[model samples]
Target: MSYEADVCIVGAGPGGALLGYLLAKKGLSVILLEQNAELGKAFRGEHLNEEGEAVLKSHNLFEAIEAHGLLRMEKLEYFNNGQLFKTIVADPTVGHLGIHVPQAHLLKVILDKTHQFPHFTCMLNTKVTQLATDESGRYVGVVASKDGISIEIASQLIIGADGRYSTIRKQSHIDMAKRKHGFDLLWAKIPAPKGWEPAIKMALIGDKQLSLFAQTNGFIQIGWNIEQGSFSELRKQAFTPFIQQLTKAFPDLTEIVVQHIQSWRDFVLLDVFSSHCDSWGTEGLVLLGDAVHTMTPTGAFGLNSALKDADCLASLLSKETIAQFDVQVFQQMREPDINEVLTKQIEKEQTFAANFLETAS
Candidate 1:
């Protein structure tokens, strides 16, 4: 093997970067690939749930994120047509009000930290062309491309953290169950009001409608749900009017649409998933993050779910030399939690989207 590593991880997203960092920390050689020329700058879940916080703390990345400015939630307000119905006060005992940090910035820090390790190698502008395995069908390495040259990188194991639309998952021959629900979330970053802070806000419309607002780095995340087919028309409209309509729908967010919304693409997220693979392991190859399971964006556990995969994968790989880790154990241990949380997110988003569709009809 010209270039051999302990683990070859695909994707440089949060899950991949965080996982790479942990693998390197364990004194294992790891190589990570990001197909994009640069990090993604799209609007994603900026809020971190309590479960996610545990993963960061375990990896000693909590303080690094907290220092970037974390806004604690004092309360999560639910409203109906602007009238407050109920409130869930932040319970510090139960990890109420997790950290608020943008995905791009958070992943950047993780990438930078991973590079600090001698055994970690992260390649940007590289795409995985083919995943190679030995004659016995045990996973080995990959065939990737950079600058139009096909380069082969061998590894003791291969990890797929490539996310929902993963090419690696397809190449791995994992029998995945994919369910395309009827709803999709519209994700966007709305600027806070002139004097308001960015916290968690759940505004419910009286016509059986629901909308979400969470804050990160002083910006509120707005996710509106709609039928899966509505995005094409929605994308053609200007964002300001859409946001203005959204502000009108909920009084909790009056004048909060000041977040420099010059275009609609800035607030677009047309995806819904209730998907999982039959297994996450195949000899020296394993699937992690959205590559293995799809999560709905409920209370900010999307990226963290992937990070947890990284954590467990590192643990499994570490024990491989001393004892052959049963990858099936890892799969069984993680699938339930991932599926449970993923179902919650999908259901919530679907409920909201259903209401919106009802109103629109």
Candidate 2:
């Protein structure tokens, strides 16, 4: 099978989907490919900050997403040794400290908006196997596989929004600098207790961070930081004593935690790392989101930064013809801000333990 478009986007996450929508809305033919048959297949970066909210609203898509469902965290509460010590409320003007937007809800609205444009095409369950280049080695399209069939897609420009371990970025031979932040995360979600308020509850356990984020559908997301590469050894230990620490920090969740997280198998372990590419583009291809700059989940900046990337790139693309497009300009415009966020994440992680200690004093 063969397809062609002005823009070819790999991945249907927030950044890729939004870029496709924005480009297609401007009347540029776009083809978006996703290896997954469905959106939100796994636990992903779902927290939306003010920057992300601004991008969604600017594009007039936030309301549609909100209609689908989202949760607004009203405040950030810090706890140490099972007692609340510091509380930071959202400014009245801002309305929320953070927003929990399920990726499914976000992608549906953007993809649905793109569907209104006749030039937009979405290929789910389609995986790009390799890049197609001309005599000059300029990327012209992608060779992908859908099910068992080979598919070829020709495009004027290709985008690598496939994420941190992006195939497009890999095939393009982009060099990425990776940094491990000395910790990994164990994530689990349990039913929110009756009348639970929407907020971010954080606890410190022996220099590690434990976070509870309230979700839209009466659920509480748990993120527990463990030593980097220590899950295997940690698992060898008894599970009961480990989980008891959670209840020790939040006694109110004792009953639910017992019911939901009885064994280690219930949690999904994430290898925490951040990465950056000095160059985000080469020839006819460009990378955005985690493909260009991957962030640790500390400040919930990854998703928002990706949204900003899509927005800025779309704006730039709108101003030029395909022949005149310059991916370097996009990198220049976005690099500084992204680098600042990456640095802030490191500082935040380093200072996390100090915050709890100061409160105790």
Candidate 3:
């Protein structure tokens, strides 16, 4: 079977969903595809920096998500050797240090709004298998599978927003130049302690790193950096002491971590890798978000960058410049900004301990 639309976006993530909403709002026919049946995911970066907030507000999508429930971190505290040393309170003018909105809520709100436009369609449980190209070998759309049945979706433009491991990008043979951060992440979430104030916490864990993010759902998200590819060996060495180290830094979390995180299985491992595509667009196909450049979660830039890309790409598409689509226009506009953020993230990861100690002193 075959379907057609003005724009076919693979992956109903933040980027794809928002782009779909934007194009559909402008009366363009769009189809957003999601391999997952549900919007909720266990491990998505939920941090909403000021830039992402501004994008949502600009699109008039912020209030609805905020009303749904979001957590505004009141402070960003730094601790050294298990001792609180500095606190940066959220400034009203600059916006809270950061806000936490579940990916589920953001995507849901965006899709709900998109549905109001008759031209927008979201296909859940559909996975793109390959790209559909014309005789001239120019890109057109995708060939996907739904419930074990083949379905072809042709569009004027095909966008790869499928995420860091983007299928569309892989199918298109885009070269993603990858950079390793030399570290991995272990993430775990448990219920917030009683009367726990909402804040972001950073702690130095015996020369390593630990961070805690307060979530709107009454959970405290805990993330710690480990040496790259060390999970197996570390788990075999007894995970209790490592977790104890975390609890030791934040005594308040002693009982909570003990109760909720007992084994290595309790923590999800995130391999830290960042990449940028050699080229972002070709003919009728373009890429956005992690599909174009994968950002590590260091400075909370991943989500916001994706949002920015979608916003800019929507504008480019609205002008219907595919025939004259020059990847340079989008790259020239976005690369510098993304480079700045990525540089900051790198600096933060490298000198975080020194900066924390210096600031504390």
What TM-score fits each model? Answer: 0.86, 0.98, 0.97
Best by lDDT: 2
Clashes of 2: 0
lDDT of 1 by residue, 99-150 (tens): 6767776786787787678888888888899988889988788999976778
- The lDDT per prediction is 0.72, 0.93, 0.87
> Which lDDT tens digits does candidate 3 get at residues 1-361?
9999988999888989999999898778999999998876759898999999999999999999998889898999887666788889988897698999999899889888976788788988999988988999889889999877899998988999999999988898889999999889999999998888789999887566799999987899998998888888998987788788888889888888899999999999999998887689787888889998999989789999999999998888764665566767888889989888888889888897784667443
lDDT for 281 in candidate 2 is 84
Please give the distance, in angstroms, between residue 355's alpha carbon in candidate 3 and its true position after superposition.
3.3
Root-mean-square deviation of each candidate, in angstroms? 3.8, 1.0, 1.6
Candidate 1 to truth, TM: 0.86
Higher-TM-score candidate among 2 and 3? 2
Error of 3 at 244 (Å): 0.8
**Ten consecutive residues with minimal summed lDDT in candidate 1?**
352-361
How would you encode candidate 2's per-residue C-alpha lDDT over 56-75 as one tens digit per residue? 99999999999999999999
Range of the 10 consecutive residues with the lowest summed lDDT in candidate 3:
318-327
- Candidate 2: regions farther than 4 A off: 359-361
